[model samples]
Target chain A: MAGKRGGNLNWFYLLLTVVVLTGVGLMVYGQVGRGKTRAGKASMAPVNLAAMAEPDLIKAARGVNRGAESARVEVMVFSDYQCPACAYFATNIEPQIVKEFVETGKIRLIAQDFPLGGSHIYGFLAARAARCAEDQGKFWEYHHQLLALQNAWAYSRVPPVETFQSYAVDLGLDAAKFNGCLNSDAHADLVTANYQLGQQAGVTGTPTVFIDGRQSLGPNDWDVLKAEIERALGL
Target chain B: MTAAPADHAPGPPANRMGIALLALIGLMIAGYMAAYMLGLLGAIICGTGGCETVQQSPWAVFLGIPVPFLGVVGYGVMLGTALLGLQPRFLADRRIAAVLLAGAVAGFGFSAYLTWLEAAVIHAWCRWCLASAGIATLLLGCAIPEVKKLRRS
Candidate 1:
């Protein structure tokens, strides 16, 4: 009688074990499927128009503006407009930094191109567009447009050159000249040079802001940036 | 007669070890779940949404439900099973106790896989997740000796 009872208990335990394992396997399947769905959704989203409109003034072999630069301290911003973190900083942090410091002439902000080629294909082109806009004296206007429209081109499998051209036209730029500049490899060297300069300056990631040539490695809110600017300015 | 008596006498020790290990696993699970809940709440309150981003990521959901919620349920089940083993009638069944420990072992293995995913693929660490993994591992380790003894008996 005892032997029969033991056998019954064994069978019951085995059944429970199988049920638990099956539950775990089902969970793994669900997780993988969800990840694929998310990836597909991300791929279908529309390109960001605001990002293309933003000006990227920093180019290779470009000399620093020594005279019109009114700030006491020089703040170099090495950024890729396509970078999400850069967009976050632009939207959440840059405005306060500009208002409290840059506009007040306490810090002169210098923009540089550090396009991450593999992930953000249009990053360099976007940088070039901003530089071309700078030639037309509308750098900051274009800068705002690019960061604002960052997600516009995010999902595009192909680079959106025509979209950028439209932005140049809307900005009252000479379309013929701008289109030629966009297609020509003329500014490619400049973009490469700026990337190299950023790398040499110990910039490991996007939106790396250098205050008086000191690298700020991580995210810096208004107060932290202001304090660094003050220290750099000897104030 | 002497040999048969020795084999039967082995039942109490196996039962005691299984219960002790299950209780320890229960405590660990409770501690981790509390931490995760607190962290999730803190993230929501801060308005940064970094916590939400981490939570919403593919890693957050295992199967269909949130991983934290699963942890909560798994830990509760473990505690319940351990309490069941404490009853006089349940303690007499050595085979049943061993099977319960085996299920706990399986839980430990799954938790290990999740921990690997978090550290390597997700490239993020959640302290509560780590604690749960650690607790599950300890429970499995404790159950091993008891399981071996049961097999011998």
Candidate 2:
């Protein structure tokens, strides 16, 4: 009886060993895959710009934009700087969208601000910081940096204005001008207007997205957004 | 605690193996977070949307190292001692039990502190961090039996 019990225990050990080894193998594999993707995203390839006719919606939107203005489909994203889901959309999904549709001239992407003022302490400030970066024609660059490095300043105890300025400096923006703009809240009204516009559009939380003037896809689901974009393009 | 009596047998093999397995799981959780911290991973897919917030908070780091990396080290030690305790040559040794108990106590205390920080201070909870805390608690529970057996012996 004791011998049988030992044999069963040995089998259990063998199974556990296999499971643990497999788990480790999978983790290492995942890390390698993620490393390659991170490298690909690190380059921040420039977007292809085309000066097509600006649509009325593009003219009405109060935020930064990319892609040909005449692109058949419009994607307007209402996002907050401190929101994680928005960060995911910016870091993971937006690149693919920019590569596939924006560069290809099939879609125009506009990012509007919707800082959840009550919840995220620095959301409004981060939005203002991005606008300051925009003053130097580096809105997209500074925008991506803010989302990608959200963790660095999102929950900081003190205001992250210096960190915001440092990011501008890193992007090779005119440090003196960017600092002046940020310190004076040069774009406070613009950010506020965008927030009011988002509220008017019935957006309660970020990152609420509208494709071709119709609300679409929850945050972080790239495949769904891709399909919606395709359907809008009638492709 | 005094040195374990020389005549004491090592912990039951089942308990040692259990501890080892749990530590391995804890290591994986911490390893994932550490990788995320280092930017090897893209995003943390969490339901509550608080994982990144908690991780990004100033409290996420202790000293100069990320907290999860410290978790990786602690769990690694637990795993090593548990596996070593399973070896036949070490089966009669009590030092492994002592090390495991010490590690478990430290881990449990640290996990509790982090959990409190999540609730009381950070006001955000990362499920992965919570899961790590759960694993640390389990490690403490698993280590207790062996140490108790050593004490009685």
**Per-residue lDDT of candidate 2, residues A44-108 (tens digit):** 32221122213433344476889998999888888889887788789988999999999999999
Per-residue lDDT of candidate 1, residues B1-153 (tens digit): 244453443333334344444444455444444454444211111112233223434566778777767766666666566545544456455664676577577779878888777655444455556667777776676566556546665
DockQ of each: 0.03, 0.21
Clashing pairs in 2: none
- CAPRI grade of model 1: incorrect
* Model 1 agreement with the true structure over A128-153: per-residue lDDT tens digits: 88888787887777766787776675
Which one is best on TM-score?
A: 2
Cα deviation at A169, candidate 2, in Å, is 3.0
Off by over 4 Å in 1: A1-60, A63-68, B1-153
Q: Could you tell me which 10 consecutive residues in candidate 1 chain A have the lowest summed lDDT?
A: A41-50
